[model samples]
Target: MADPIDPSGLGRLLSETMSALGQFGGGPQDDVVPPEGVGEAADGMVRAAVAPPGRVTALALDPRVMRMASESLAEEITRAVNGALADLQEKAAGAVPGQVDLGGLGDQLRRIQEDAGRQLTKFTDSLIEAQDRLARQGGK
Candidate 1:
């Protein structure tokens, strides 16, 4: 026998689907920028702050660092930039959902689809049975 249609279950599934999709849509967080990631090198003589999309928002050099040889200064700068980029990458990774989250969402959607299909099939079967009963009564 087919399962009975459940309006409450269907409503709950639709709500869940909307909630999941809302995570990927624009919201209050859309207007807010993530905090910049700061990194330092050479005993804090060089510092860099990186923003999202790996943009360098700021770079600072201690006065003492200016006296270093050009090659050494460049190396310090490279180290600071790399550290800043690494920090930014870590933060961004934490902010985004991983593969497991996406996979779970896919599974949820599939279950909703299956549930809806089952409900529709049940409703159709019920309607057909009622029509058949009505036809037999009219033929008598």
Candidate 2:
């Protein structure tokens, strides 16, 4: 039989994703204004987007505790993305979606989270690039 998935795996994903985001984001002290902040926020958002949930399964946290942390982290990521969007919209007068529109974004995020298998594509591409560079060096 296939390995059982923890019922709380999604929660774990959220928590671990948040933890990774926190590291990527630094802290309030790291914040800058306008475009730089937007760039940093977008990077954080993509890191979460690109994170694979299977890794969450491998974490050693207590399932019950991690589940709660996951919920909070998911909320934090949503807020962080929306907050960045809002700030950028104010500065750029562009069409950043409102926080209320996060439902649509969240739907996309859920799909990404569920289809974590595709993460291997990134690794495969990276390996190919490394091999190409080595070939260019004539096996140096």
Candidate 3:
């Protein structure tokens, strides 16, 4: 026989499900203060720092880099920025969960719906049975 559904247990399941879903949005990650990512190019003559959401927070060029030709200077700057963005991405990935089991969550929800449907059917059957019994007794 299937276990009887307990309202408290159903409530707890819903609470847990909501909590798990919340993690994907703004749970633990909200508290994490992501560290800035810094990168250097051309022997550290060009430096760049990036923050969360791929925003470049700072760029610095060593006085020595000024002597380089315009094209080389631009290349070094681009390299520094790209490196900083990459570093930021790597760090951010580390700070967050690697994967979310949305399929699992969907399966869980489907099970819950099935259970509710079964319970409703059982209740309806019981009500009908009771009504029939009462009608028979009244006719006597």
- The C-alpha lDDT values of all candidates are 0.82, 0.45, 0.80
Best by TM-score: 3
**Which ten contiguous residues of candidate 2 have the minimum total lDDT?**
50-59
Is 1 or 2 the stronger prediction by lDDT? 1
Clashes of each: 0, 0, 0
**C-alpha RMSD in Å of predicted model 1 compared with the true structure:** 5.5
lDDT of 3 by residue, 83-126 (tens): 99988888877867667788876777777677667766666676
Can you write out model 2's per-residue Cα lDDT over 1-140, one digit (the tens) per residue?
22444445556667656654444444344554333223112224322111111121111223343345566655655555455455544554442223343565466556657644444444456677778889999966
TM-score result, candidate 1? 0.58
TM-score of 3: 0.60
TM-score of each model, in listed order: 0.58, 0.22, 0.60
Question: What C-alpha lDDT, on a 0 to 100 scale, does residue 105 get in candidate 1?
Answer: 69
Model 3 misplaced stretches (Cα beyond 4 Å): 1-10, 23-28, 114-140
What is the Cα-based lDDT of residue 11 in candidate 1? 82
